[model samples]
Target: MFWSKKNGNKSQEFQEILKLRSELSFKGIQFDKALFQLLTPLFEENPLLFKDWKDLQNKVLQAVEEKTWTIQDEIEFIESYVNLWKIAKSDELHTQLTIKGNQQDIQIFPLITFGAIQNALQLGYNSMREHPLKIRIQLSQSTLQLEVSNRVNHYLQNQADNMQFEYWKNRLEYRYPEKHQLFVNSNSNIFKSTLILQIA
Candidate 1:
């Protein structure tokens, strides 16, 4: 069959993708990096049928079955992804950046990205309600800049008491190698961290 036909076996492919998506969704699985990496081979053979969320879910499940990826495995993957995105989105940068000197030509540190995200989440919180922090993301050509500035009671100096923050920072370094930059500062009663990421 000609690859350009876009008809032959298309129905079967869609069925397989749909079936995979349904199974994973029922299993409450989130297709994340670890799962993807573990299942790349299965997907490599079949190729991706669709890029839609539903399609991706199916691809993920297909990989899981072939690679024996467990739900716990997917959970860990999601935990990391959520942590990264959550912090990057919520924390805000100190608006009036005081550049003391020239733009220091420093190698970007990935841990900084994780740190920046962690800092933002910590800074933006209110006990009055549940889930008070909100994070926003913007990606540009050269950098994936994240702003996580949230309204909270604590200041920059006092927010480091929690162990989770430290743990996350370490995890960031483990994941990013040397491809990230993190800047954290506060102004006008808001705690924020900016993560500038150089995509590899």
Candidate 2:
């Protein structure tokens, strides 16, 4: 009877041990996962991301020789580009893309949002599943808008960033000078940028 009782107690302790491991809790404080845990997800994701990366690169290369894009073309490029980031991050980063208007037969500057998105991902506040990085595109009869927002990462705040706003500024000035507006600011630990161009 004593032997059986001791065996049952050992089984209970083993179960508790497993519970503790799965919960990853100690003294009621949860532990952050080890960095190594990211490797599995990264490896699993790169194969698909490689294909996406190639496609994006090709698009960019083609654009260098022929710089022409319609609103719908840019829309498709952003969708694919953002999807690359989504897959590469493997849910380590959260992303949302919302488009609320139909395509129009209007020309738009291609790759306008790429730099902004790169900045958002690189300067992510947490780059964790709980945080959100959003890219929004809103098209109306008169205006086309692209906006990106993310929590500011304090750690990278001190580092120099080359967003090349000048390049975009020149492009916008040349294309839509008086017809476009550019807004960028990092206030209260939130970084946001929006470009609105008059298409009509």
Candidate 3:
């Protein structure tokens, strides 16, 4: 009985070590992937522009070694990743942005919240001139809200774009614990997604 219990504990410990290693490996792969995805356009357009390619390579290695990101850290990480991609694409493409409405002091996972909304703005809207997408951030007494609204085509009957939004919603639950709420709605010619984070 003593040997069985000791072995069980050892097995549990070994499993935990494997789990941690697996998570680290997955994050390392994702970091590399996100960087490649961001930098590929730059390399394709002007290889010389990536003059500091070695610096980027070092950063990825460091990030992996540190196991650097928490659930909350992923927001800023993705935001920075996407922002670089946008800047790289700007040489040939013009991406316009309009920021309106009020900004608030959101205490919980600010980077993630900002990144989700930023990425959503790019992906959620079909066109800037015709069906413009609007994202607004506001704060109440104890709650912070991110509202994303976009005009859609009348012929499209389903909320096909919501699957992407749903991924962020799940991330919030995992990252924010019990402090976040997400509301999503679609109507004729419009789709709206709202994320509410309660101040802790």
Each model's backbone clash number: 11, 0, 1
Error at 71, model 2, angstroms: 1.8
Model 3 has an lDDT value of 0.51
Tens digits of per-residue lDDT for model 1, 1-200: 45655675896686565555434332332333433443444443544412332354554445532233332333333344444333333343222111121222333322233344444433455333333443444444445565665555554454644554544443443444476666656555556666656643
Worst 10 residues of 2 by lDDT: 23-32
> Clash pairs of candidate 3?
75-112
TM-score of each: 0.37, 0.66, 0.49
Best-to-worst order by lDDT is 2, 3, 1
Where model 3 places Cα greater than 4 Å from the true spot, the runs are 1-39, 47-106, 114-123, 153-164
Per-residue CA lDDT of model 3 for 74-167, tens digit only, reads 3344434444544554543223333333333334542434334443434454445555555555655576666766664455554535443344
Q: What TM-score should be assigned to candidate 1?
A: 0.37
The number of the candidate with the highest lDDT is 2
Clashes of 3: 1
CA shift of 193, model 2, Å: 0.7
